[model samples]
Target: MNLFENAIKLRGFLAEDAKVPPSDGITEDAFSVLFLALMSGTWDIATNEWAPRTTVHRVVCPGPWFCGFTRGMKRGDYVEVEGELYIHDYDRPVVVEGERSTAKRYVSEIRAIQVRKLDRPLLVIDTGEDG
Candidate 1:
């Protein structure tokens, strides 16, 4: 098989190995709501203050701390978030300075891990589910 098929097979094996029995719900990070919003093309514009668009398809909670903590994450660190997503708009693009834009969207989660990039303020959001 080709590389893609190999990767898929490997992923299935990894999932089987990593799978754990579901536990009682854990507290998820707040930013997960924002994550969902960016993916679903929606945002909260209701408050129009800290989250000026309070009415957004707000995915990832985007808590005050999450926003602040992104500055502190290192190359190997992981962040966690828990929240829901709105389904209003996804107009503003998730633009990385150099990387090409993607059609893929964000998903909801309780927590995330942020892998730091060299010489950049943004971190790759490790949704715990996806890389």
Candidate 2:
């Protein structure tokens, strides 16, 4: 037997408000999508310093419960998300080198099973000068 698993956990700030599309009357459950920005530091061996890096990720909150939970989140809010990774592939029209064409696009997103808002203060820097 072969065992497989796909899981991801991320801690970051909400890049924007949760996006929930209006119900189409086909599905009873509500769905939501969120953009999160994760920041980290990368160390450079030669430079002997650390550099900041930011990555934005798309998170999907499916079902009425998850959607409702995300509705309270807003931009700049720190949050933690736990979920599974999913990749969606679709065709999109594009113009490459002045030629119109259709291309296949792949989008990787996290299907969130758990989300939590963390109460943390933003970093502040003081220059010691008062105006």
Candidate 3:
């Protein structure tokens, strides 16, 4: 499922059992990359209702996969869903990216949510129904 579904379905599980994973390295996958791209696109999709300007990088796949990397991804870090982040999976329909060995499995504790910045502008994940 995508972020929206993760929120509605996976979040419950995270809060209960998804041990708040200690910051660590992680791998990545195609699914993770695609998801992030869609999320990045949400910004422009919300403002304009027509052909967009400048081919923006809605999302960027961080390559086929990385070996030893962490979630230091900034607003422009071609992310590929770096395994489990700071989640507390409590056994629910959570989305996991596997584990740290290859990837850090994770569940969306917070999805389709906004940043806590008064002027940083809002960010929305377009978790379409297809997910």
Candidate 4:
């Protein structure tokens, strides 16, 4: 199987309330909305084995199916987000003096596919239910 098949789950409080903006794509109409924000701080590494493998922070933008939950979410509220992991390399233009060069910028991002608010005990839980 490919690396993308390995999905990870993260539980943390949002740095701020999610921002919902109308979709800008040509395919998207007025009904579209996006949830964009950062899942701040660090994952509870001691509680689970997956927490230690992730970065301290993650830029989360849940897909359309999960966007509804963002409307009532507030900063500091607990949330559980599931996403596929991928490492992206971007070419950033850097200039020293007058010469310009492109530098490789690597970013570890999780493209969130599903998100849910956590109201019960424990940061991470296996619901034992499938989609």
Q: What alpha-carbon RMSD in Å does predicted model 3 have with respect to the real structure?
A: 17.6
Worst 10-residue lDDT window, candidate 1: 6-15
Question: Please, what are the lDDT tens digits per residue for candidate 2 over residues 8-124?
Answer: 999989999888765452155667999999989889999998799989999988887776677678899899999999998999999989999998999999999999899976688
lDDT of 1 by residue, 1-131 (tens): 55532110000000011111123322343332221212123445795533322111222324444444443333222223332223332434456887656455544233323312234235477577664
Please list the C-alpha lDDT of all candidates, in the order they appear. Answer: 0.30, 0.86, 0.28, 0.60
Q: Which tens-of-lDDT digit does each residue in 1-131 have in candidate 3? A: 46542322111101111111233433243211222322212335666655433222221223223211222333433322322223443433444575333334444322222111123334697898997
Question: Which clashing pairs does model 2 show?
Answer: none
Return the candidate ranking by TM-score, descending: 2, 4, 1, 3
TM-score of each: 0.21, 0.78, 0.18, 0.58
Instruction: For model 3, state the Cα shift of residue 41 in Å.
Output: 9.0
lDDT of 4: 0.60
Order of the predicted models by lDDT, top scorer first: 2, 4, 1, 3
Candidate 2: RMSD to truth: 4.0
Q: How accurate is candidate 2 locally (lDDT)?
A: 0.86
- Cα RMSD to the true fold for all candidates: 20.1, 4.0, 17.6, 9.7
> Can you tell me which runs of candidate 3 are displaced by over 4 Å?
1-20, 23-68, 80-131
